[model samples]
Target: MISKSKVTAKLSVIDRFLPLWIFVAMGLGVALGRVYPAIGPALDAVKVGGVSLPIAIGLFWMMYPVLAKVRYGKLQSVSANGKLFGASLAFNWILGPILMFALAWLLLPDQPHYRTGLILIGLARCIAMVLIWNMLAKGSGEVAALLVALNSVFQILCYSVMGWFFITVVPTWLGAESTEFHVSMWEIAKSVLLFLGLPLVAGALTRVGFVRSRGEEWYEKKFLPKVGPAALLGLLYTIVLMFAMQGDKIVSLPFDVLRIALPLVLYFGIMFTSAFLLSKKLGFSYQETASLSFTAAGNNFELAIAVAIGLFGISSGEALAGVVGPLIEVPALLALVYLSLWLKDRLFPADVRANETAEPKDQATSLAQGGQLR
Candidate 1:
């Protein structure tokens, strides 16, 4: 088994200090917003097709690099694992939404707006950040990419219907007051298309184009390293902008934020732990298990925040809850990354050979050698 110190040493400086960097970004964002309140308004004023321009840029920049690292050629191999697909679908769609709804109402019964916001988050399965988390956890990039793409398709199709049901219909079934929530399908579609579709196409095209022209050797070795660091940079950039825009709310409403954060924390913990255990139980390798866990644990906070802001207004508790999703998720998932590695050493030791067989050597080695796995 790889020692803890050895695994830690294998991570790049950026990966090693990811939590520290994210916290620093959050602090810097809060400071920027606190010092320059107008910054938020100015940023809000510049919209790209009704989405904040800065945020759109950050999301694109953040997702593109990670997506570019996906081994699209190996997708068939990942997809052939029907068990993995079915299990992922069940965890992300069925268990995930129900769990979040239970947590939201159970934890924040008094805060309807916040409860609704959390439900929206639950409906929006992750597309973007799962790749980064999967990569960091030394999971299968191919599986991560495929699962993310699958979730995006599901997100585009079911998000609105599920949002209405969870926030509106389910409450009445449970003898509570049903909230009236309406969201435009086009809006959800637009967000998915822009945030997920654009980067995905770019990434796939880049891989296909580069690998075909430059040969696999040059593309993996020379090109990927240049692009790998950008994923971290864009992630930090997105976090800063997100926090900066809502820094006032986060700073002033500490107690309320904490109230909203509690359910989200519970949601992430339960989702990740359950997924990890179930995946392992199902006989998946550590790599596939990590991919499934992160995908199951993460949410499309961008979509949740946008929908909440549009429907409930930026200053509403719903929006505040949506904003808090990533604040909690970033740290929560980072902790899970380490937890996954630790678990790998203990629970997944027997499956190491399976994982090595499932994953390409260069891909697995890249994580230890400062290259992003593809």
Candidate 2:
């Protein structure tokens, strides 16, 4: 078992490097986009049986570490915390979808594909990235792990249902064509599996391997640290490829990016505020509150992008909207991370000071607690 102190300590180091690494990745992505346009298409290829595998492999690699850390038992933990679970579920499913639909309808009236893209973005919930955010906020890793698992299950079921409703029922009710519903649903599911399922399986397997071989301690101390940088790098690499693939589209509609970004920004701001306020009202500790807040705020862009590409084509405005999500999100999350640290100082001043004072004592406590951390 991992101890909380060790978890916190590891996260502190991760918090320091995550931003710089992500920035480097973003820069590299821009360069890659400019230098290798042809390679971008090649990377997008998907293979099931001896064919070209999808470029979503990058997403898979990125999320594997975090998934591996999740314990199955933690799913029960999330269930037990019904209030938090319900709040998160309502935001991700009910409020998120409604807001996204409205935003897409309002912002991209001329671009139906882009509208669907926005809907996809809102429907997908955070899995891996939320883990990082939760950690930064000093939330319980166990709870974070639980939420990741629950969200993954929810996304798989709800994405298809909500997506179908969006493309079919909603559109038809509004006098739009529903002819594309079947085709769109098929494409969406395929994209979800390629982007989400594959990564989840790979990540879970990797987690099992690390736990078995490294004995959790080594896994925590060594393996997990490596994940933060890798994830940042992966994001950068993917974004660059996305830019290369969509540069012309983006250049053609420069103003559209801002339009696309609006709902996402609103969604983040609203969700974060709601989570923090609700968590506080529930009397959650700072760590738990921050975790709840961020988990609700973050979007799962990989799934959204894949679905956007499948539904609307790689060069479509929908895909472009999906790409912009992370461009806005990465910086926003970094800011949140800093804010979490600052909040720790203000709201939990004594705890923060005690944490500082007890830094050395943490290791001693870990030893005394028989090396159990979580």
**Candidate 2 residue-pair clash tally:** 7
What are the Cα lDDT values of the candidates? 0.84, 0.65
- lDDT tens digits by residue: candidate 1, 1-374: 33446555656777667789999999999899999999898888887635689989998998888888888989997899999999999999999999999998889888888998899899989988777788778788889888887997888788888888888888999898887788777887788788888998998999999999999889888898888788888989988998888898889999998998898888899999999999989999888999999999999898888889888898888899998899899989988888887898699876655555665433324342232322
lDDT, model 1, position 202: 98
Model 2, range 132-178, lDDT digits (tens) per residue? 56654556666666666667777766777787898779989998766
lDDT of 1: 0.84
Candidate 1: clashing pairs of residues: none
TM-score of candidate 1 against the unseen true structure = 0.92
| Pairs that clash in candidate 2 | 2-373, 2-374, 3-373, 4-373, 29-240, 46-54, 64-203
Q: Which parts of model 1 have CA positions greater than 4 angstroms off?
A: 1-12, 351-374
Which model scores highest in lDDT? 1
lDDT of 2: 0.65
